[model samples]
Target chain A: MTALAPLATLSRRRFQLTTRTPRELLVPLVTPMLFALVIAPALKEALHTGTAYEAFVAVGTVGLLVPLNTMFSGLSVIVDRENGAQRELLAAPVPRSFLVLGNLSVALAVTAFQVVALILFALARGIDFHTGAAGLGWFVGAGVLFAIGMYGMAETLANRVPKQEEYIARVPAIAIVPWFLAGALFPITALPGFLTWVARFLPLTHGLALMRYGLLGDASGLEHIWSMGSNTAMAALSLGVVAVFAAALTAVSIRVFARTALR
Target chain B: MIEVRQLRKVYPGDVEAVKGIDFEVAPGEIFGLLGPNGAGKSTTIGMLTTTIRPSGGSARVGGFDVAENPLAARRVSSVVFQEPVVDRSLSGRTNLELHARLWRVEPGVARQRIAELSDALGVADLLDRAVGDYSGGERRRLEIARALVSEPRVLFLDEPTVGLDPRIRHELLEVIGRLRAGTDLTILLTTHYLDEAERLCDRIAVMHEGRIVALDHPQRLRHELGRELVELHVRDDLPAALAVLRAHGIPAEDAFSVGSTLTVPLRDLSAGEAIATINDLGVATAISAREPTLDDVYLRLTGDRLAPAA
Candidate 1:
């Protein structure tokens, strides 16, 4: 029962936060599609090879959308803290880790929905996958990892920035900048050497690379993979790396959240 | 049910909010922490509930050390913060249900407890409405209901009626009284209202500068100061009236002018002697004698009024 407390909390928060109307659902769904539509056509000629540029852009857009949703969802912690609801949860008998996991669970659900929707949209646009079922499976796996990692990053930011105005002003820089540098907007090779080095360390970069390998089957010429390796091996390596990063960030987030929450 | 010894809270900056305070609360007792603003009443409650760590000393809730075994302490205690903590976007019922689950209450028990608490708190009609639409008093009652849904052994209410209207404050106090009569829950309430402390508390700890200046039953604390308070409304020559009372063997320190009102604290002196002294001085217009009150005790101990001018 104690171990399941977080799941119960997650259920309540999910119900409170779930989109209530079609219009609300359309907002998160349409924004990413619009970005893909506007950017994919412009980059088609330059990046088109084995895979259509539209597919690449769609995968990258899903990567961006997942983190975007997770970051915004995780910001609810800051709202809860500011409004004093966080204190109620903190003072409860449940472990502090439950609070962190409960908040991230909402982010994870939203991310999964966005990823699946984008995959369907890509398929409708005539994008081909190397291994259809396996590709979809990897996409879901990578999206979950990316979502969890971003949730941790956002929770950490929420704990550090105590004031709403400060959090509002600072969070976009932290959340959006990494997506741009992670090769979501453009190819990693197009970036300067220093930026490419920095992007290699971002979890989203690995996530996007994994998704591309899953869907397009190793579009190495398009800067999807850093080395000329087996598509299966590269995909496996990316998944493993992202899993480690996600777990590490989750641990850090729980520790920092417990400290700031009770401080 | 609750015990603390020299509990302290020092913030990051060298500022000490709660400087070494000690107190104990027994089962089913409504203990009050009475103090002025910034006297560390809320800080003390925070430490005991395990929401804030103490810088020094120790506290125990239901025999569980709050610092070392916070989960156990939290299991036995619940706190209603001074500020509004209910989620305004959620319905009152939803808020209470969520709290019930977070505390690991069984589903059947949670449903029954929520219904009981909402009915007892007189919020049954408002439970389905969004908390954002509820009035301040309604929100306060719902928050208390949320706290009680967990069936905690100790309840901490930090200035539960601070921002409500007087009528609502009276109503909520009645609800608290009913809650006490109905349950074995121990309550630790903090308030600056002297009447509130006197009316509701079994024992009052008057906190000043983060220390317990006086701790006793309200009547005992007031009686320790004196039996009666005399106020003289003087028309002319206030000092002469004070001198006349002193010359008649009244202690000079007992009588002093506060904004043209000569106030006196008397133990056994008769009203006739006070009236005769004033008449002999020929400088007084009116005089009145009243029973000792918590206000007098607060003024005597802290040299400051508990509540500020409205």
Candidate 2:
């Protein structure tokens, strides 16, 4: 059987579920701007950067919020399990992997929309760096990839975690701690020598750096440790790393969810 | 149609839920797995529905091996679990159409089938309202409509009337009874409700402690107790009553007591002979005669009362 039709239908349902509930959309849309307003000025003079700190915080906010909000979508799995909807869906004739993909795709699209809205919100808030349409396009791409990679990790947790209480207890370690270590609140170059090394390997580091490059037009200036090449080549390298992150984690999550969903 | 052979499921920590039971259901038949909670009725349904992996043996649904070809098996069958599964946030029509799409029913055909199934299930009037607004029985009707939207060949209902009030339960029963009158669908339902099994199933397999203790037409199973039961009440002296009956050629083993009443199976004895024998003994007691029921059949097969809960 063709997987396209069912995946599309399931994706549509996920999208419908998301839109019908406005609270899920709120964190992605409003929380980033709140961060730009509240945290950017406090760190403005403490850390010197090429762009205004508000601009830096704008990309950081988007970077952190996009993945965090998308990952939270995994909570739906637990809710469906409690309510018996998951059993109904599992008994359907569709391939199990398609269900994982459907969840991933809708998260990507919703976060992509959030990316655009956040950019416009930053502009309206008077945080200026890049005004080009192509830059906004790159921001959306980075947000989508960031969401994809993190959502994959979330699905793995959702399928494997036994209870909602346990899953929520783990959200900080899995989704939040990485952002702090990855320099979403600031630049990783400010971190200590050993902590900097730890930050270099995280997908969130590159994802946040890539998003800054797209919106701030300075490549976040945090890529020098891994690159001796020009800034453009550095940006391309960050994009490649984030793409690999998205693909690998998504593949693993689909496999894990397929086996774990059965009783 | 459904078939199972030597099916077993040993849960983690070595809890054997279903132990090598065998049965088959013909197409268009209303087969039942009757047992109280934890008797492995739900576990057997889980295996046949492809939600649970079988530890050993085999099961097939609509000719597809559940373990080897679960998706194919799922395509030809549907299940209504004991748990409430309909999405309460959405309207009944939306829920039905959503399920239709997941099963890849063509959009046009899905719409038509949604309409038909809702009308048939008596949920047509409530289709436009969100399911959260529905009563328990209404939501159940909508769930059944959603299961039927794909037009499955085999339908599994696991305790379909468990939580409903009596009036609503019988109402749902009538809905299912109507489905049983037709030959287009095969149904496998589980219920501890004796009267439901007695009224609905073409044949039932009475399960106890993970095995099929009895499998036959409901009437035949009840026949194990006898055509009718002779009820004997003694104010006191049950042993004397027993001795008196045994002296009249009715063995004490053939009669059992519940409270003050001693129930004697009226195998060949007419009510008059039993009454005359009691009079011959010059004993004072109250007596009555009644037909045997499925409750007696289950009690005879398994000493435990067939309760509704796990």
Candidate 3:
């Protein structure tokens, strides 16, 4: 426990910040709901696919929540630089892993709330989420990997960019725009044939397919990808892809942050 | 407690921020780096504090090489950065507690140390308040307390009084003076303010353009010019006036001019004698003699006044 004290303190700071101003959490919470209220009706009416739209779009919105909340961790790092606290933290004798993991810890804690809220919203819409414990595990594992991998990208942008304006303009586009091209609103089949390959390569596309399959018990979304015969194989492959991506990006982000932070 | 040998820093693009410089601070001495902006004072502090790695050479704080083993150097030292480093969103106490954890201070001892530091710094009552609401002075005092929580062997303060109002700056100076007197901790501070260095530092290194042009005790740095200085406020033609004074048998080698003011070291003549001797050189508008100061020493070496940057 003593060895974990630094991480514990890092985790505790997020709640303290939330206590001071509950509004930091408010923006991320309101984001998915706003999309649901404003955009869901038009999209659902256009699809003309009864009830599948809500279930599909809800999972998509859940995808949005991963980037929505996790990206704040990167923004908070920039804010820390402005206030000079980041430099002091970098200068401390604590392990570098503590600082990076501490940020991920905060992102995950906030992500839990966003995930639950979206789940409740899906249930409220009369959407039946059909799955057993294994499917649920797939949903959990897919979401965690997607969150960590996306967070690494966001943090890398935060460290690499020198100007705050550039970071603000680019981080949101990188974080939020992927859900659009991926299967967030429309599945990959809806895209033009050339764009289908682009959508297939996006990590979120696979993560979203697994999450939608986890809840809806439909692997039709995963069928076109390499023409896999079974949903289990597709799910396993997607999990591997996202896991390797998460690991690679985590390694890259850690190296990038160390260079800018230490010197 | 702090030793620096040929410590240098060259930023990317071949821009040298700190040229090779060597200086050692005694175990318990309060040493100051006095220079104007762009003189590399903060860069020196940054390198010594291990925030910026030196491009060449080495620095050690508390016997650990900052570059070879930065973590060990960091463990035995803390720094009060030139800018506010406390988390404004957290309570003051939480900020100190977080620092304690970062340094791995034992929780039981950390609590007691935090209590004692805040009380001594006159911020114990405000420990639970958010740091965003703190006045500048309160925030600064808390930064100091946070730095001290680790019980570091060496402390670096980079332009500690840069943003404070004069009264708060004075009070903080007294607090720092009291702090040094009460402990054997070695302290190195960088400042653009001549008075800050004179009031707190036992030895002062006057830096100019990334080099330590003069290093000595504050009074001794001043003493390099003699006991007192004869200052002549010239109306115009500074060079002409200096030349005229030389024709009047004043040694041309010992006088320097800055901004229409001519300063000649008063070695062989009294203020009145020097005044009468150079009176009506036609360029001389006013003349006065006074005891030497760090400002005089800094100006002589750097050709710039070490004015308070704030």
Best by DockQ: 3
**Model 3: share of real contacts kept:** 0.73
DockQ of each candidate, alpha-carbon based? 0.64, 0.59, 0.64
Top TM-score hit: 3
- The deviation in Å at residue A99 for candidate 2 is 1.6
Better candidate number, 1 or 3, judged by lDDT:
3
- Looking at model 3 chain B, report the run of 10 residues with the lowest lDDT sum: B301-310
**Compared with the true structure, what per-residue lDDT tens digits does model 1 show for residues B239-274?**
666666777776546454556676777777776676
Ranking by DockQ: 3, 1, 2
RMSD values, in order shown: 3.8, 4.0, 3.2
| CA lDDT, candidate 2, residue B226 | 71
| A2-110 per-residue lDDT for model 3 (tens digits) | 7787777777765566556565576777878876655776677876666778777888888888887777667777777777478788778876666777777777777
Q: Which pairs in model 2 have colliding backbones?
A: none
Residue A215, model 3, lDDT: 80
Q: Best candidate per lDDT, number?
A: 3
Worst 10 residues of 1 chain A by lDDT: A17-26
Whole-model Cα lDDT per candidate?
0.80, 0.81, 0.82
Residue pairs clashing, model 3: none
TM for every model, in the order presented, reads 0.90, 0.89, 0.94
Model 1 chain B weakest lDDT span, ten residues long: B301-310
**Residue range B87-187, candidate 2, lDDT tens digits:** 67778888888788887788899999888888888889999998889999998988888988898999999999999999999999999988756557999
